[model samples]
Target: MHLPEIDRYGRGHSPLHRLDPRLKLPALGVFLLATNLTWKLPLAALFLLVAFLLTLLSRLPTNFVLWHLRAPAALGLILAFLLAIFTPGAPLVGPVTREGANLAATVFFKILASFLYFISMVATAPLFRTIQAARALGAPEKLLALFLFTYRYLFALLDRARNLSLAMQARGFREKTDRRTYELKARLYALLFLRAYEETERVLLAMYARGFSNPRVTLPQPLTSAQVLRGLPLLSLALLLLALNFFW
Candidate 1:
C-alpha cells in the first residue's frame, strides 16, 4: 500500500490495530449491523458518534477516514434530495416533507456510521488477517476469492491505464474533441482490454501449472484474554444499542 494508492491509509499499529482479527471482525460486524438496523434517529446519531470515537481510537490519520467518506457523503446527499422531494408527508418546506426529511436523516446517519466503522476496521487492521478472519468465521470461499481477486485487479487495471496514458504522451498524442481523437481513444481502450485479457490468461495458466492455492495463512489460534477485553467495549455497545432499539 503506497501513497496515492487506494487502501494506502489501511496500515497502522494502534491498540485497536493490534487486537486479534478474530475478535475485531465480529465486534465491528456487530456494530455495523446494529448501526444499520436501528431506526430511531437518536439511536442512529448515537451510533454515528460511537463509530467516530472508535475511528479516533484506531489512530489512523484523520485523512484516512475522511478520504473514504467523500463518495458516501455524496450518495447520502443524493438520497436526501430525492427522498425529501418525493416522499409524501406533512409539508415541511418547498417539496420537502417532515417525514421525508426524517427518513433521509436516518439513512444519512446510518451510511456515515457504517463508513466510519469500516474505516476503523480497514485502516488499522491488516488485509490478509481480515480475510482470514472472514474465512475462519465460515464466509464462503468463492465469495472471498472473488473479493480478493477484484481488489487485486483494481491496482492492475489502474496501472494498465496509467501505462497507456504515459505511452500516448511519449508519442506526442493530444486529446481533441474530434472524431480522430475519439477513434484513437477507443483504440487505446481496446488495446488495454486485450492486454488485461492476455494478462489474466497468463496468470490463470501459471496458476494451473503451479497448482495455485490461497496464500498460506495461519490465523492466531488462541483468543487471548487481552484481545477479548479490547473487543468487549464495542461488542457490548453494539448489543446495548440493539437492545435499546428492539426492547427499550
Candidate 2:
C-alpha cells in the first residue's frame, strides 16, 4: 500500500549522488560497455579500480558497495569456474589452461567493475528518478511504466503471498519434505499468480476510470550547457577505456 524506501544512500552529499540522473545513466552505460569490451586482464583491473574510485566519490559506505557485489561476485566466480574448465588452451593445471585463466580473470574484472559502477550511479539515486531519466533518454514510455509499476508494487504482492502463507499456517499446514507439501506449495504459487493477474486487471480498470487514457507522463527538466559539460569527464573515461582495449 505504501511506497517502499529505495534511496537508502540518497541522503549523502557526494557529487555522484547529486549528479543529474540523465547524465549519470548514460555515463554508467558507456562505462559498463567499455569495461566489458576490454580484453586485456590488466586493462580490466584498471577499469575496476576506476569504478571503485567512483564508488568512493559516491560517498556510500565502502562496505555497502562490497556487500551489494556479493551476489554478482558469487555468480562471477561460478562463471569463471565454468569458463576455466570448458575453454581449452595451453594446459596450466589439470583441466585449467592459461587461456581459461585469462578469460576467467577478464570475466571477474568486468563483472566486478560493472557492478561497482552501477552501485555508484544507481544505488546513490532514487530508483524512480533514474527510471525517469531513462525516459528522458528516449526509452519507451509504456515499457517504463510497466516496469515502474511492477517494481513499485512488488512488495505488496509479496505481502499478499505472505499473508496467504500465514493463513495456511493458521489452518495447521506444516511444511515438510513430502510430495504433498510440494504440491500444496505449487498450488499456493498458482493461486498467487492468479491473484496478481486479477489485481492487475482491477488496477487497469481503475486507471481507465480515473482518466488515465492518453495519460500525460511527466518529463524531467532539460539539461543546461554547464550540466552537459560536467558529464564529459565520465564520457572521456569510457572512451579512454574503449581505446585501451585496442592496444597490446
Candidate 3:
C-alpha cells in the first residue's frame, strides 16, 4: 500500500520548519481568530500579506500551496457571486449592491488568510508531531486517540481502494454512466467497509493481547529559551493583529 507523502517540504532547513509545534499551534489559532474578526479591507489585506510571507518562509512549493487553494478559491467565487446578486443594499454598479460586494470581498480575503495560515501551521509539520502538540495543548484524550488512529489508517484505506480499482480494471471493468457502473461502485464500497471492519478488529485484539491499557503518549522535549525567542515573532504578529482588530 503506497501512501502519498505529507509535509514533503517539512524536512527542509528553514527556520519556520524547525520551530516547535507546541508554540506554532497556539499562534496559528490566534492568527486565524484575528483575521476572522476584521472586516476592514486594509486590515484584511495586511493579514493576507502576512499569511503569504509566512508561507514563503516555510519554504513550501508555490505550486503546492496554489493547488490546495483551488477549492477555497472556487468557493469564494461562488460566495461573491451570490452576494453580488442577492444581498440587500444600494446598488454599487449594475445590479450588484455595495453592502454585498463589500461583504463578499471580506469573506474572500478571510478565506485566503485562514487557508495560508493552515498550510504554514499544520501542513509544514509532520502529522505525528502535530498530534503531539495537540495532546500537549490539553486536547481530550479520547479525541486525540481517535485523530491519531484515523490519520494512521487513512492512507492504508486509500491504498486498499486503489488496489481494488486496479484489479477491477485488469479484469476488464470500465466505468460507464449507467446503473451497472453504479452497482459495481456500491459493491466496491461494501467490500472496503467489510475489510476495514476486519482489520480494525484484528488491531484491537492485538492491542489487547499486548496489554495496551492507558496508552501513554510522550511529550516533546521541554521548550528552551532560545526556542521561545525564535517563536516570538509569530506570537508578536498574532498579538499585534489582535490588538489592531480591537483597537484600530
State the RMSD for candidate 1.
3.2
Better of 1 and 3 by lDDT: 3
lDDT of 3 by residue, 99-144 (tens): 8888888888889999999888887888778778888899877788
* True-vs-predicted CA distance for residue 53, candidate 2, Å: 1.0
Clashing pairs in model 3, backbone N/Cα/C closer than 3 A: none
Return the clash pairs for model 1, or none.
none
Name the candidate that leads on TM-score. 3
Model 2 Cα lDDT, one tens digit per residue, 1-248: 33434467766778887678898888888888888787788988999999989988988876676667788999999999999978989999999999999999999989999998888888878887888889999988988887877786788798898888988899899999999999989989999999999998998899888888763346888988887787778778777777777773
The TM-score, computed over Cα atoms with residue i paired to residue i, of candidate 2 is 0.88
- C-alpha lDDT of all candidate models, in order: 0.79, 0.84, 0.86
Screening candidate 2 with a backbone cut-off below 3 angstroms (N, C-alpha, C), the clashing residue pairs are none
Angstrom error of the Cα, residue 131, model 3: value is 1.3
lDDT of 2: 0.84
Show where candidate 3 strays beyond 4 Å: 1-6, 171-178
lDDT of 1 by residue, 1-248 (tens): 22254446556677778776777778778888888788788888998998888888888777756777889999998997898888899999999999999988988999999988887876676676788788878787777778888777877788878888889889999999999899989999899889899999998989878988764434446676877887787677767876777864
